[model samples]
Target: MKKAFVAFILLIFISTSRAAKVTDWLDSYNVLWTSQSKGSYDSMPCGGGDIGLNVWVENNELLFYISRSGSLDENNCLLKSGRIRVKLTPNPFINSGFSQQLNLRKGFVDVNAGNTNIRLWVNVFSPVIHVDINSKEKLSAEVYYENWRYKDRPVRKGEGNANSYKWAIPKGLVTKADVIENSTDKVIFYHKNDAQTVFDVTVAQQGMDSVKSKMYNPIGNLTSGGMLFGDNLKFAGTSSGEYAGTDYKSWCMKSVKPSSSHHVLIALHTQQTESLNQWKQGLADIVKGIKSNDDKKRTQAWWNSFWNKSAIRINEKNKDSEAWKIGRNYQLFRYMLGCNAYGSYPTKFNGGLFTFDPARVDSTLNFTPDFRKWGGGTMTAQNQRLVYFPMLKSGDFDMMTSQFDFYLRILKNAELRSKVYWNHEGGCFTEQIENFGLPNPSEYGWKRPANFDKGLEYNAWLEYQWDTVLEFCNMILETKEYNNEKIDKYVPLIESVLTFFDEHYRMLATQRGRKVLDGDGHLVLYPGSACETYKMAYNSTSTISALTVVLEKMIEYSAADSTKSARWKQMLSTIPPITIREENGKKMIAPAKLWERINNIESPQLYPVFPWRVYGVGKKDLDVAVNTYFSDSDALKFRSHIGWKQDNIFAACLGLTKEAQRLTSLKMKDSELRFPTFWGPGYDWTPDHNWGGSGMIGLQEMLMQTNGEQILLFPAWPAEWNVHFKMHAPKNTTVEAELKDGKVTSLQVYPAERMKDVVIMIKK
Candidate 1:
């Protein structure tokens, strides 16, 4: 018994020692700089709890652009809350001893110079921004609330891209000014939405005006912004200036007296209310709820828990290696995702909440800091799916709620589209959908043929692309698979989405002929699309795979009662089999059985190997999927590591080590920006989130994959690249493993019974 006790104590020490090494490895990835930034483009990201700030020190002044999730303006643009500037009287920032560090472990920014230091952080549980300053000598601080929307500004020809208007802005469209109130020690500001927002225009444009009153409008009476106040500070009047080619006004607050230490707080609030006073009360409530004594500790604890959930560190002994960089970037991008863990809306794939000025991204487009190519409030499921899919393996299930809730909130609106248009059942979600669950007006077509279907988008790229929402539905179900979490709230959404495909396709078939099913007793599935790539397709492979997998999982998980399960099984039987054909003497999956034309560069043929998981490392007929990856003309032509590209993912899923390594390295390489992971403007905006997300998925897939109850380890990972990783799998399980010199040094599988399911593919 004594010997057993001694061994147990030794085991505890070894476990603690391994944990410390992991923590130290994570610390090495924290960003650090010894000099001031040139502009916002070179800033570091810092925030939490749905708020993101582009933080930087420039010209001896501390400046940060504040952005919060769901800050939609009258034009349906996701606007920045505002910019805040801080200046200290005896400014230490100008001193030679200057440094700025983003401590990822604590989720805060630390700026130091001479004898003064400043720390910036956002409360993870509250909508509040905090800046704490410490100094050896007494110093006065001046805080400014800057707003470029001080007066109504007309959006230029190209600037309308930031809003829902895209390139089809209505005449005389203008971004209204914000309201600012200055007081003795505080400055409060807000932008209340105009009564007539894009929701009203979109309803009329989509021929839904008759039922507009019943549709959900997220922008109506929406008030967003907050109060900036500090200890021992007094209002110092206002000033006007120009920033990034736009005019702005500032409300200044200066310290009443010099002090050795000071604190500043900016409390933000956003709500759709009938009265402005009610919104103000909400903001006041946030301030009153600020538990100063323990908020910081609690926020720090949250970040700590976040880091401990899941991690991947590669080549820990060599930080500069490309292998190490891939792992570092994976964590960095995950940090950005963590910033909006509790957001009301999902993170945007274009830039999320960290976009800077447009000029910085494209020198020709000199627009405001809020400028992003894609329309704000528009959810592109094709790109947005990439952003949230990686969270499952990383065990960030809580963050997935925002994206799931987004669909739930608008389920009624989406169902309304089907009822009003085709007089049928099921939710009809379009590819480019607005916040209120309707096709984007611009994509719906400003000038359309008189008889064109009002229900379908007229644009070639987005028309008949209703299948992308299936990816999200599958993600919602996977949350239960990975964490065994209750998904009662999402069951109705899943049923509605599946019902749409079944009923709508049947309705279309009945319109074309007498029978709803084809000669083979299956849905015809004509006029369908294979992602935006194969248009006017017959029996699209992507659509079939999505429907088949989701239905099978639904029945397997018993997400529904006996009656619903019976219907799902019947529908599953009707889904057409994924089509495969011989290309150059090699059997390969076809994009579809037939297609009229190709519209984009996406490769949907291999999608079944991925998202749908019909064929993969351990699945049947893997050779056919591998043949498509290598032999298909469109697949080869479209292979790339650019934004939203999934070649790396396909290669990983197929267990192609060399191919996966080459593609994923390119995807995860350091970007041109100072921040290593701020990848792109590839096909969207700078700090391309989907780009990072796809990279994360590729890396995670290379390391681990699951087939039913089996866990495949090092499926496609390079043996030479040492790694320590912890990833979540189905059945509420987690696998943590360490590999060094092409050998497994240690392995731990939660719930010891799962050890039998682990397959070590890497040979020693």
Candidate 2:
């Protein structure tokens, strides 16, 4: 009773504090769609834990697409749990003052129309969706299941880009097999993969067919299904057929008990087991577990803590201004990230878990909910890193584990592939990695060039792009710094990843016709690429910088182990220096020492400024870093505060107050969509995770910067901007501050001992 009372009081205190911190901002910025949506394109996103729902009212009925993280199909593709449609007999939503709002504070959607108030919320702890409808008078409700893959569908061209270069590749790619379903109102549908799923296809494509017996196949035989169950409802009818060039299957369940209120719930489950009864039992357990209100309270508690982790609020300079938009969108985007707090896999960079129909996104695409621009199983390291980097400053450490576990799960396979091919003791990760740690089969280049190296990927952009893994390595180390995380679990991964470059490059140096060692007798990185740009380059700055920074940290962390520390120090010494060249009379960080031509658009030069943090706001050589930011032609040409853009990051790191604010304002502004947070497919799909993540990182960096015992406040903030922020830093430190009208009203640094590190940047 005492514990319960304490929890309740803590909840109340948090509630009150949250109200003071963000209620005004959320009220002014919550997404409010006044009219019915045209289609799924304009759906409102809502989710908790791993479950995601895209809710929208269409044609006098409410519809939503249900999806869950880590629910991959046979082809290693992320699958959706079908769509749900609810309609009332009285039709309260037809031309009757419709309003759909995503309540930011409560983390639920409230749809009000006519005399009905419909509340839609998903339980974070349990995989259950809740719908409660209340009306002035008793009314009947009909819930429908819309399944698109009822029958065996052929893998058609342009259906999805998952197969990758279908026109060029002649390999036969089969679509999903027939879905298992029943004709009853208590509808349950599942997709089961046989032994001959895409897992076999990818293994063959990557030339790992010989080692197929040794590979870990998560999709060899997997079952993922959803069940609809609710009291006060009975079987109404069923429909199975095609409509308007689309095939689908559905079952209708109608309210049996006549009451003023109606409650309906759906529980979803997935498993590696193939037994149908076991899968059914899993769903049954979910329903049973969610019946009690315990999970709901726990869910609320989880979200309550998530909202209180770290936050930022901007004083509204003017209506719809950039500053106001940045602040509001930061919270909105963070809400989206929080929805999948317990995802099995990391939230994807393209669409994360909130993707609607492809046909809805673009009529030309006309694909299923499972379809995304990149392959479903493919986790592009370049884009994927951006999605997780911001979690450090935001103090979303638990969320970072999903990504860490993803790499850890596949680490053994990565190391095995390297050993099998090169007889090495390291893990080789390409740009496009399958969920199970192999190059994406489709993008591995169907047509092999003459004498092409089998070990290296055939795709030009991904060739020799193993250094991207280091960013995640850095994230792991940084997590330890901020939280005192157990380094034992992640040390192997970091060691093996770094070992690949160390041993592989040295071996390659000996094979080259000419001596490939620099003046210091260090191995020269040749035949490398600078982030899909500067192909066939030597000494790529990004790769070198990654090796140098990660090696130093590894040595520092492993000081107790003399042998490991010595090896790390030696490797660090062997890394070539980051190149600097005079461009138009200004010295700037060069992408590489030598290269043939540009292949892709990415400013790897600024990597030293942000992720590596070799130079930053309070670091040495600030002018050179600042000059690189302004003078780099590639960065200037490709710069935009859109999807995957890092302009805010660079500006903030350089302490460019005005530029940081400007870029971040643009980065966080409402995207041209009904949902403000659905930023773009700007080189990626809708609701870009990288765009939101970069914006979050920029906002946090603008407020505070931590560099080696020094914590600087308002490092890159505009003098006129008034703000309130609390963010995590290294050494288990958190800095909370409020800046109002160019004056520091309050400041608090946790652990009081660390207060000496705080340096308030006051503008006069």
On TM-score, the candidate that comes out on top is 1
Cα lDDT tens digits for candidate 2, 1-764: 01111111211212112223434344665778888888777889899988889999888889898988877776676878888889897888876888999887667899999899998888987788888889997888998878887766666676546543333433455557546454444767777777676667667766677777777777666777777756777777778765324678888888886667888888888787768788778887887777536766777677767877777878865655677777778888888888888888889898988887776566787666767777677788888888888888888998888888888888888888888778878998888888888887656776787677767788767788888888999999989999988868989999999999877887788787566466787878987878887788899988988899899999999899999999999888889899988977888888899998888887888888878888897688878888889988888897888788888999988888888888888888888878888888778788788888888888888888877888877778886888877788889887666777776666666766776777766444
Error of 1 at 729 (Å): 0.6
What lDDT score is found at residue 509 in candidate 1? Answer: 93
Work out candidate 2's RMSD over C-alphas. 5.7
lDDT of 1: 0.90
- Residue-pair clashes, model 1: 0
- Pairs clashing in candidate 2? 681-684
Candidate 1 structure quality by residue, lDDT tens digits, 1-764: 01112112212212312233245556898989998999998999999999999999999999999999999999989999899999998888764599999998989999999999999999999999999999999999999999998888888899988999999988999988899998898999999997789999999988998888898999989999999998878999999988878778999999999999889999999999989999999999999998765899999889988998889999989987998988888989999999999998999999999999889899988988878988789989999999999999999999999999999999999999999999989999889899899998998899999899999999999889999989999999899889988998898888999999999999999999899998889998989999999999999999999999899989976644788778899999899999999967889999999999999999999999888888988889999999999999999999999999999999999988889999999999999898888899989998899999999999999999988888888888888999999888998787788888876777777766777777767532
Show the lowest summed lDDT stretch of 10 residues, model 1: 1-10
* Local distance difference test values of all predictions, in order: 0.90, 0.79
Model 1 stretches with alpha carbons more than 4 Å out: 1-24
